[model samples]
Target: MNQEHDAGPGRSGVSRRNFLGGGLVAAAVTPLLTGQAEAKAAAAPTVDGVAQVTVRAAVNGSPVTVRVDPRATLLDTLRERLDLKGTKKGCDRGQCGACTVHVDGRRVLSCLTLAATTTGREVTTIEGLADGDRLHPMQQAFVEHDGLQCGFCTPGQIMSAVAMVDDEGGADSDDEIRERMSGNICRCSAYPRIVDAIRDAQQVMR
Candidate 1:
């Protein structure tokens, strides 16, 4: 009787089956529980977080639609989303002119600009200024005059020059031109060539 009980038929197999069944039940239930949890999270209320706003602005001479974090600066949106990598981020603050772009034909520091606020305004960047292979006169002049070294600040410099030239900001004497354009600084100490480039380009534009 003891031997028969010790060799009990299919007892280990029955226990194994029970363990596997329990594991299967738990495995099936976990995903369902996770889905329920996610659904509950979805039902949670929205609160004080910043709202995303979609804006339409003329970027690189093309109309574009972008949805951006409301708090994101125009510079961040332009560089990150619009793929206008020419605008350098020298100082996130407005002190540096490296992030300048033509906003509605005027030079606006993109670093200080708000993307949502610039909707429907014409924003011109370095990439947009050229007509296909032909460079914008300022770009050509900058190259001819060697207006850059390291070239990190070249885009913003030229963009500012474009705005300056458009506004006849370069019409003044060299000192005044230098004074007005003084906001833009070149780390490479290329100011003299930059001024010459602007002067050279001014004559061509006139």
Candidate 2:
């Protein structure tokens, strides 16, 4: 006849008052637990007696020195440590090129690249693609060509296209551009417009 005992078989019968109190306790504790975890992770983890490595690298044209867990990826350092969120974190396994960025002017998947490996290199994210108030040519071309939708993948797409043009000397043909840019996936299916933007930017870039 008790409401607390009416929760049915295979379950622990909890009173309404107890349930609410438990929820309140959990709500109060969760943030503290999360903050502790975040603080620990942000402190740069140690492994096998080795402390976090001090990496001095150039990011978006500025020099940065940070202690990073040797296992941390460049994507994490850029987004979490440096607060450059323009580099998207779409499939972190490198299947999605949304985290693509320029390392020494070559396009590389940031999520799969180790932060330690970039110690002496120049890393350019979407934030660095522009020159003070002016968008990079490829960025402008994408806008003019209507090359993006939803825009989640736009940064990576533009970065990849710019590097591709530099590497190949030109966009050449639509098919060639598609082949070279096959790594960056746009779920919006804006492939045609993206190709057009690349062609347009390549002329100006050249």
Candidate that would win on TM-score: 2
Candidate 2 lDDT tens digits, 9-62: 223576433543211111111221122343354443343334556567888888
lDDT string for model 1 (1-206, tens) is 11122322244666422443211111111121122343343221211233445567778777676554455588877776666789988977887699989988999898888887988899988888899999989999999999999898888898888888886456467787788788798888999999999999988876
Clashing pairs in 2: none
List per-candidate RMSD values in Å.
18.4, 11.2
Under the 3 Å rule for N, CA and C atoms, how many clashes does model 2 have? Answer: 0
Q: Rate the local accuracy (lDDT) of all candidates.
A: 0.71, 0.77
lDDT of 1 at 42: 29
Best model per lDDT? 2
Count of steric clashes across candidates, in order? 0, 0
- TM per model? 0.75, 0.76
